[model samples]
Target: MMHRVAGAPLAFAALRSQLEVPGDFAPAVRAEAAQSAQTVELPPEDATDVPFVTIDPAGSRDLDQALHIAASGDGHLVSYAIADVAAFVRPGGEIDSEAHRRGETLYFPDTRVPLHPPELSEGAASLLPNQVRPAVLWRIELSGDGSVRSVDVRRAKVRSTAQLDYDGVQAGLDRGTLPDPIAALPDVGRARLALARKRHAINLALPEQSVTGDGAGGWVLALRTTLPVEQYNAEISLLTGMCAAQVMLDGGIGILRTVPPPDKGAVQSLRRAARALGISWPDGAPAGDVLDSVDRSDPRHVAFIEHAVALLRGSGYTPFNGAPPSQPLHSGIAAPYAHVTAPLRRLVDRYGSEICLALRAGIAVPDWVRVALPELPEEMQKADHLAHEVDRAVVDATEAWLLRDRVGDVFPAVVIDADERAGTVVLDSPAVRARCAGADLPVGERIQVRLVTADVDQREVRFERADSSQL
Candidate 1:
């Protein structure tokens, strides 16, 4: 069942305006992007015969990475083709300056503020099927155990055989009818996941709350669970990123996506919550394993997973030159990582890819990249903050709209979090998570909650324990 809201577009527009989100490209930027799209040069190396396929959300036009995996002497060769935004966006050019200011794409429920003009992001530089586009191709050689043997990145002209989506790919895998180019995805993904677990990587299988357009001029708020194939696809990207981080570290200059180790206090809190929720977290078992072992469909397990999100709080971009940062690890991955796979949407990926390409080719890092390294962290942080705010606001507004007509009605909910005065609850139907106020609210237990206020204008939804308030 879907919970829908009418006139959501107006609210979204107001939110965008209030947040000062970038609206449209300047005339010069648009002209530059259009001209580059028409006259961009393709790389000399031809990888069109590799039969690469791209997997992303359905109807995604800004295609980023394409992949083709095949057997190689009891191992696997993963040919990953990333959109070469550098080919079209000259350093210090109009697109480059604008992308730096924006840092990354800002997504909304109704639309997105793209980092680059759609001419390049969605048309020319995108790795669309049947179109020969310039790409930064990573030829990753992995052993039978998913251990990396060698990594090579270079510019090339590539054509994707098909543009697949997560749902279709998952269905194909279940039916054993996936195409030859990506048939080994399951095996490779599993191997990489095993390696991740061995390293104590933290993988949270949390349900995503998203707002989508309803058929008629309204919006629907829904909860989505990650499919197995999606996790497999993510493993491939993570593999490429870890390899990129190693190359940059060896080369002695680049930025990294870093996170400090999870707080000791947070881990303890999660362990206690797990016990209260009746989830089996074995003695000394890493949180990731316990999370992976839970049944995601259960209310108590879902509540436990929600509490575990505290472990992923302090992620940020860490740029380094000549000397590495003191804390270089992304704690969740339990390894050093770089963002080099999605140049079409993110500003840093383009720079990170350039560093890897030059390092792999035994050349000096470009002067433009060196000049921009120190500033990237701040820019990306600003963008991250704005993106988070926009996402939260949209969800809040949608939740308010969903419950606007049902004020005073009661629903079954699981108290996922609690403190002295208030807490948070997750409703089973309509998939709403909102603030609740009551004395001594029980954590990790199912209870009845009464909707008190659903203020769409304020983008607030609040509830009280059903027994604490009288209708």
Candidate 2:
């Protein structure tokens, strides 16, 4: 049930301390940030010919990428420019060592510890609104069939025409008055939508959850999914990143983000669950195929998606100096992938961009980059976990705070997951996922429940079935 808790702070003091960013890094980092801000040269302030716009959450200062799209001889050409973190952080320098130690930017509910200091990350390096900045750019051509025809990567100076947020772009698309550069969104969106549907045809469609701040020291948990435009924009980034990973892998060098494919046992378990829920499966068909036939609106489907999410567990950073992992495919994107789009926030992107830069130049990869490459996977893994842990701790605490006042409220909810003993239910009225107990869940069943208790300090929401059947 949705209820509000007032007067409680959303941010947790202990988690913030645990996620404590080494704001007091070596003196070299400060000097480098200051030097970086001063010596950096921006491109012509008047190079406004390209209709590039920065798309990010509203109030996002550490913008990492800017994009522009245009028609190119019966195909579409997209130019993406990412902040060039490599250009500034010298090899093995203080900032480099510190960033290597941290791996990535850490985000929390109330604050963020940038991988690079604001003077760089959110300031000079960011492709901020109306600012000309140095960038490593990727230009890609896609045929009508959504296949890549060619790719170009280089260093360039560019300026953003405007800053746009996701919902604004979605609203513009819905209104049919999108700006010219983004008018292609709907077309590309449809193509990407088809691509996702195809993947679903062969894979599970998982329901992922993202937590949002409620402005009053609490959180509103939202069931996030690949919105049409979100998926469309992501495809462009993914294609480019995949191309970069391919080029690197083919060259016998570079780090790739990988997650092992799901096991047959899990697939079988999902199949049994599907049969229990009355969903049809083709003879000897894969779990992915069965998922495609299910109705997402049904509570059973939500449960299936949550279970499917387990298939993507244990994703990590993988580095290689020629021989790729035994498995190169990223099951989520259904392609091998690398991090190349957000140099401003990710240390590995700086190295990936450098590799792409060198590959484009037809030069041997720089000794500095090659030497530093071996250590990146671990550093990046630590950073990734730290960032995620901070975000998770904050959101969990905030959700607990928000529900603290609604102990007796009841709301409609659907079962989204079940184990041998307990399960989870997602409240339908508002954006919240809560824990359900007792043996009555039945995995995919829908039922009403009262908020038995909400403990902000404990960071949990306990629910009971509204029906007297529990009694």
Candidate 3:
């Protein structure tokens, strides 16, 4: 089942109009920000001194996480300093209410509505390089096989020494001459890389595209996770988040980003899809595991991954105010998980971090967090819907524009979805699903087809069989 439904018709102009502040829309999170807007005293820059760097987009204002690696007793320890948004925004205050209402930072190709105001998100709480800021640090110890041995989270102040981008990191990692700190920790990097390959061996290989700021005129659609280091860095964050979730759940209360296991019927459908694509599977393995293996080995794995995407459906925000719920873990991550990082971009993380902090301190979970727990699910759902709509609209529009003039051109495409009765086929690249125009197309098959028509104005692309020579 396709759980990610088609987006509603909410135009960018309308959402922009709604997000406009009312001239005095909670200028700062508190009066302290107003008092020393010029030169506020900040935390020590020891973290920044140790070659801590930020790895985000080209022109991101609110940097959320920074990393620093140092030698430990036997191995290396990773100090991950995340922006402490929970400290700045008071619970139930005006700014807090606004953040809660917003629920998350919604990003579109043309516009973005940040979760917190710029003074805090882009200034005080941001982990900008060379600027010391308060941070909630997670110190994790990693074994040689990439297993996390010990984990610690606490309130601390830190700075980021350098800011790095994905492209730069990829280039450095490839050339084997990365800058000082990142280059110094070869074992840590190797462990992280090994861990990433281990994860990809089991996790679903889904592709993601991010619309980046073009800087000159508009935005450009770029596929994320193309580089190996992208996956490596993501695994670090995931390790921390899973550890935090475990800490909270073990203490008897915590919210989870939960997705129920794929249904047996859904798994069976995927298995049939594999057979249709001429891929073999073991006798009694789990569907997810089989799909992961096929994705790694099969030539048509791109299309197969698309089909496997349908198996895991309906992910949602589940709050555990009183006790943790009995549910299967997220099959994609291959572990139980929750969102504790990126508090600057997400509202739930602020409260979630507070819960974790209190639990670690052996104190009762704050009443504010407990009382706000039930409302979190619905709020997060709304924000998620809004974000998805924005993303799909932008990508759909861009692809339509790119293919507007090449209507009759033929290109190799991996089949994402197909319907025999409707004569429909969806391509993986450009993500345009269209009708086959009077013929049946098999699902999970790859072929070259001509674009019969493309209407950029209508956001529609149509396809047909090309000549024998071309096909």
Against the hidden reference, what TM-scores do the models get? Answer: 0.97, 0.90, 0.84
Minimum summed lDDT over a 10-residue window in model 3 is located at 1-10
Judged by lDDT against the true structure, how good is candidate 3? 0.69
Candidate 3's C-alpha runs over 4 A off are 1-50, 183-202, 210-225, 294-299, 405-412, 422-439, 448-458, 464-471
Tens digit per residue, CA lDDT, model 1, 27-69: 9999999999999999899999999999999889999999999
lDDT of 1 at 218: 87
- Write the residue-wise lDDT of candidate 3 on 1-471 in tens digits: 011212323244654444442222455444544443345444443444455788887678889988876666667688888888866766777678888778788776555678877777788789887887878788888776667889888777787888888888888888997766555344675675566455532467565655544555544555444566676677767877788888878888888888777788887887887788777778876665566456543336656677777666888877775567888266567677888889989988887787787888789988998899888989999888777766666565555665676777886654556665434454545555566653456555666778877665555667775657755
Per-model RMSD to reference: 1.5, 3.0, 5.3
Q: What is the lDDT of candidate 2?
A: 0.74
CA lDDT, every prediction?
A: 0.91, 0.74, 0.69
Error of 3 at 415 (Å): 2.2
**Position 452, candidate 2: lDDT:** 87
For candidate 1, report its TM-score: 0.97
Decide which is better by TM-score, 1 or 2.
Answer: 1
Cα lDDT of candidate 1 equals 0.91
